[model samples]
Target chain A: MTPEDMDLLAALGRTRAGLKVEADKHYVVESRLAPLARREGYPSIEALVAALRAKREERLIWAVVEALTVNDTAFFRDRATFAFLRETALPELSRRRKDGSVRIWSAACSTGQEIYSLAIAADEARNLEPGVRFEFFASDLSERCLEKAQSGLYTQFEVQRGLPIRLLIKHFENHDETWAISPRIRQAVRWRRINLMSDLSGMGAFDLVMLRNVLPGLDLSVRARLIENLAARLTEDGLLVLGEAESLAGVTEALHPVAGRPGVFARDPAYRAAAA
Target chain B: MKTCLVVDDSRVIRKVARRALEDIGFDIAEAADGMEALAWCRAAMPDAVLLDWNMPVMNGLEFLQRLRQEPGGDAPVVVFCTVENKVENIRLALDHGADEYIMKPFDGEIIAAKFAEAGLL
Candidate 1:
């Protein structure tokens, strides 16, 4: 790919998806977009970029943006996070809520694994507090990924990653070569096609918002804005879960890290009082 | 050096499983069928057993039953690695003392993940 092609694709990614394609990561862009260009019937990457620059076609443009976005995820990705949710987060939320209803949002839920994992956590939480009920809301930028997530069908290889054997047997129906998650688990969540760069006020507040592994790929300004939007959508006592390696050090102080938890954050009381 | 006895009538499957199990730091042993697996267990109990559902002479379920009756047979973690995908088959294996069930066409990653879940890794 030419330098000009790289710049155009980078600009397209940033403007459309809030993704920041680093100058050094040109290979990542090329590797991901090469197949896309071929499938789109373009002779070369340069031809595809030229076509993109010529006119703004919504379908093709969004296709390029979605391809650039990283969608790597697995079931119960970090076991410790779910353990903390089961042992501490769910119990505490159950204690505080008098109506016995807790709402969760899986922001940037790629291929539905994370959301289903959250569903499993909620399903098992009945053992802790029988009165507590969880409502799930999940969203993604990619329509294709969302479709796969909606299907709840996973290949043998996909099911092997980070999924415990017991949960696999319990929650999924085994087919010849694929596993489909039970309808009870799939229907528990409300799915939407959302762009975090835009306004989020229409969506209701959540008790727990999981924006894991998303911020790292976004530009700096977009990350802060996304965090602010996420913070606004969280209830006063709601929690926000980020990726393990992610931090809010230079990001907005709308939320503060919950003590003793690496990735989990709580709505900052100070920020809330000031906003009030 | 935890030992795992891979029991399958098919030598190809046994070899594939041996390579995968060895890659994850397990001492490997191969058995032709359930009877040989039972004999191997009678002499020395392995840390785990990767058993196939169907085989000549003695099948996986039969071997599991007989192994459980042996003096120290209940020690090994028996994981049924077979083409059996039916829920009834899975329930049967679990009911007959199998610890976990993995469908066929598995790889090293699956073995590692399952072993880790079973606390053998």
Candidate 2:
């Protein structure tokens, strides 16, 4: 593909999914989009881009964005994040609420492992405090991911990635070569297909919003907008969880990291005051 | 390097388990059946055991009961690798000192994951 084609693809990534496709990542664009182009009956990626530029097709544009977006995730991806959730977040949220209800949103929960992991943790938490009610909401940019997450079925290789054996045996039913998560765990989360770059005010506030490992690959402006969108959904005392390597520094002042906690964030006191 | 004793009646299963274990950095030792596995353990205890349920001369559960009685036998992480997918069978193995269980048709990834969960990896 030519420089203009690469630029168009990069622009689509940024505008649609907040992904930053640098010029150096031209090969990534080629390799990932190659199969998509072929599947969509285009002779080449250039042809696909030609069609994209000729007429702005929403379906084709989303297909390109989803193809480029990396959905590499596993159960309990960052141990410390879940440790904080179980040890600190759950107890504090349970105590702070008089109604004994807590709502959590797994923003950008790719393929459902993160949400299921959250469900498993929450289920375990309920044993300790029977009165506490946990509501799970998960959204991803890709319809493909949302469908797979909804199915709650995983291959042997998929299940092996970060899932504990005991939990696997407990929550998943083995069906020959595949494992399907129990209905109890599967039905716990409400799944939605949402592009975080768009307005998020329609989605109600969540006590914990998890947008892990998503921002690092996004363009600077997109990162700012996406973080603002996620933070807007957080209740006043709510926490935001990002990937371990991700930080709010220079991204947005809407949320600030909880002191000493690596990826945990809370609505900025200044941001909250301004909103108030 | 950690040592694992792969005890299965089928040589093919033993070979597969051996390659899988070795790939994940385990020094592998193989036995054709429970009796052979017991004899090997008596000489030198392995760090872990990939055990099969059914075999000639002795069975997995029987070997497990006997192994746990021997000195230093408790050191090995005995993981049952078998065609037995029944929950009752798994409970029986765990009740008889098996550390973890993997159903049949397992691959390197499954073994690695089970080993990781067992704290053997």
Candidate 3:
């Protein structure tokens, strides 16, 4: 790929999707966009990159990014992460809540798995304390994934990823070849398109925000900024969950690990005191 | 939007598959044999692949296995669109990572439904 193409692809990935496409991965980018170039009537990758640089076709630019956006997720992808939510995080948040309701946000909740996992956990949690309620907000950068998630449908491979057979039978109904999640579970959650790189203040405060399995791929500055931004929206007594491998250790001081839970975090008291 | 790469030794087969997929609004590409298909996939990963068996060069099973070894190999949804309908052949293709299988002499309707079943359409 030419230097110009690299720059254009890199810029588009960064600005539009929070994806940082390295020069080495140009093959991945080119292959993804080659079909786009053909469909859009650009003769070659060069022509496509040139057109993208010269003018911004909203649809074309988005097509490239969308193609590059890999909707890689499965239900309860990390057992420990969801286990934390079911056992410790949700219960602690429930006890502290003034209202019977608790709001949980699943940022970049790709294909609805992570958010739905939370909903299942919330459902299980509610059974123990009949009065407590759960409200969910799930958002992703890819509109395609959001659509799939909103449908609450999954293929066999998707359901087999980590969903226990019991929950699968109880919460989902088979439709042709796919499993459509039960309406009650679907109704408990809200879906939206939100690129984390942009403003997030519009989404109001939440008691638990599951931004798991997403940080390690990002640039250091981006990781820090995103963590800080998410922390800002947490209610004073809220929790922020990261992938097991992720951390706020060096990223930002706005959030810190809650003493006992491994991947769960809370706004640092010093930061909170200072903010107030 | 979804993308698909149709691979077959027969030009007519490739043509038909491409047309059928294009009508469904897929951005489609084609390769005549497994060797060319491997090159295409290594460069950029398609959302799905419609593959064929019994090619002169690397066969579909060979290509699928080799492709699985490449970086980002797990990304594509593969459907073995071939004449090999033997139980062993189907099992082998599925074991080799073919997401679905369709017999030859298929139409747009079959293509649409199979792809839909594979969660690609």
Chain B TM-score, one value per candidate, order as shown: 0.98, 0.98, 0.96
Q: What fraction of correct interface contacts does each candidate retain?
A: 0.50, 0.25, 0.00
Model 2 regions more than 4 Å off: A258-261, A268-276, B8-28, B52-61, B81-92, B102-112
User: How far is A95's C-alpha from truth in model 3 (Å)?
Assistant: 1.6
What is candidate 1's lDDT per residue for A1-276, written digit by digit as tens? 778777888888899889989877888988888888999999987788888888778899999999899999988777778877876787677776755788999999989999999888877775455666788889999998999999999987788777876688899997777899999999998999998887899998888899998998998868888998998999888889998778999888888877667788888654333212
Share of native C-alpha contacts between chains A and B (below 8 angstroms) recovered by candidate 1: 0.50
Better of 1 and 2 by TM-score: 1
Q: Write the per-residue lDDT of candidate 3 for residues A31-108, one digit (tens) a residue.
A: 778877898899998888788777888977887787666567778766667766787667766766635788899998
Worst 10 residues of 3 chain A by lDDT: A267-276
True contacts kept of 2: 0.25
Error of 2 at A52 (Å): 2.5
Interface RMSD of each: 1.8, 2.9, 11.2
Give the TM-score ranking, best first: 1, 2, 3
Scoring only the A-chain of each prediction against the true A-chain gives TM-scores of 0.93, 0.92, 0.88
Ranking by DockQ: 1, 2, 3
Candidate 2, residues A1-276: lDDT per residue as tens digits?
898888888888987777889877788889989989999999998899999998798999999999888788999887667877877677777776646789999989889999999999877664235567889999998898999999999986787667765677888887775889999999989999998888899999898998888887788878877778787888888888888877888778888777667888888554333222
For model 1, state the Cα shift of residue A150 in Å. 1.5
**Candidate 1: which pairs clash?**
none
Candidate 3 lDDT, B1-121, residue by residue in tens? 7889899999999889999999888998899899999899988899999999999978999999998999998889998888764445767888888777776667886687667667675
Query: Candidate 2 chain A: worst 10 consecutive residues by lDDT?
Result: A267-276
